[model samples]
Target: MRIATWNVNSVRQRLDHLLGYLGAVAPDVLCLQELKCTDDSFPRQEIEAAGYHCNVHGQKGFNGVAILSRRPVEATAGLPGEPEDTQARFIEARVPDGGGEILVASIYLPNGNPVGTDKYPYKLRFMDRLAAHARQRLAEGATLVLAGDYNVIPDRRDAADPEAWVHDALFLPETRERYRTLVSLGLTDALRATTDHAGVYSFWDYQAGAWQRNKGIRIDHLLLSSRAADRLVDVTIDKDMRAAEKPSDHVPVRIDLR
Candidate 1:
């Protein structure tokens, strides 16, 4: 099975680029984040015509997520145990691939910029809820994959200039610790598990020649549960998409499994 994740930034704005990718790469399942549009505004017709079934969880102007699968799928929207949390940042589903179904989530983790504000704490709380949910799913013996623009830089190895992000919310000690806690639950950071290579980035800021200089960060990820990771075949970052016409600041990260 091939699963891919990309923060399309704005699905409407990047629809063309996204269609191009669907044709070019053709992942069996594509998890999308940052839709920035309401469910009614999602390009369902275009997507369906391209031959994928989509499950979208979106709000009017910001923070939305979706899961697109080539095969049939059953999906449930939003993160569990956070009824108070209304942000459109999570969507989960079960997609079959001949052998069995795998649980997949398209997540748009909080950016939590401007530290020391309410946003930072929300970010941590969100991670905690997700961690709890992940732990439950793991206990159920599901082949699970949590993929999206995590918005956390994990480690220095994930950032081009680690010092530059040291004080930023995404790389702050507390935030990184929360991410570590998630992985400690036995989720495999698929890309990291597949290779030890450095300088492999999945996102580049549109400002300051970040893409031109190849100064990017590997924030977008496809973390798999052991039940799924055992089938891992390869992991790839579609860096070429960053160079495409009116591209997203981030690129796609894909993982293949048996």
Candidate 2:
């Protein structure tokens, strides 16, 4: 199975670029974040016509997520479970086939920019909720895969310039610790499992000529449970996608498994 994750920034703005990549790479399952559209605005017909079934959880303007799969996707629950925090940031789905049932989650974690602000606290709180949810999923004995723009950098090896990000929200010690706590529950960083090298990035700043200079951050990721990671074959970041016309600030990170 091939699963891919990308933060499209705004699905409507990058729909063309997305369609082109979908045709070329053709992952069995594609998880998207930052759709930046209301549920009604999601282009369902266009996506369905491309031979994939989509399960979308979206709100207006910012922070949306969706899962697209070649097989039937049974809509599951959204994360955190707080009725007041319904910003469409999480969605789970099950793809049932003869082999078994595959559980996939698409997430858009809080960006948490400008540390020492409300957003930063929300990011930490959100991480706690995510950790709890992951623990529940692990207990269910499901072949689980969680993919998305995590918005938190796990370590110095995952960042372009570690010094520059010292005080940034993504690299803050507390935030990183929360991420570590969650993954400690038997989830593997599928990309890091294949290589130990640094300077591999998935996102670049549009305002800073970061892409041209190759100054980027590896924020997006595919973290899988042991049940799924055992079958991992390959992991790749489509850096080329970042150069596409009207491309997203982020690009796709793909994992191929048995």
Most TM-score-accurate candidate: 1
Q: Please identify model 1 stretches exceeding 4 Å from their true place.
A: none
Give the alpha carbon lDDT tens digit for every residue of 38-154 in model 2: 879998888888888988898898889999899888976578646678778898888774669778899889988888789898888888998899899899998889899999888
Q: What is the C-alpha local distance difference test score of candidate 1?
A: 0.92
Q: Kindly report which residue pairs in candidate 1 clash with one another.
A: none
Best by lDDT: 1
Give the Å shift of residue 69 in candidate 2.
Answer: 1.0
Off by over 4 Å in 2: none
TM-score of each: 0.98, 0.97
Clashing pairs in 2: none
Clashes of each: 0, 0
Q: Which consecutive 10 residues in model 1 have the weakest lDDT in total?
A: 92-101
lDDT digits (tens) for residues 199-222 of candidate 1: 999999999999999889889988
Global lDDT of each candidate: 0.92, 0.89
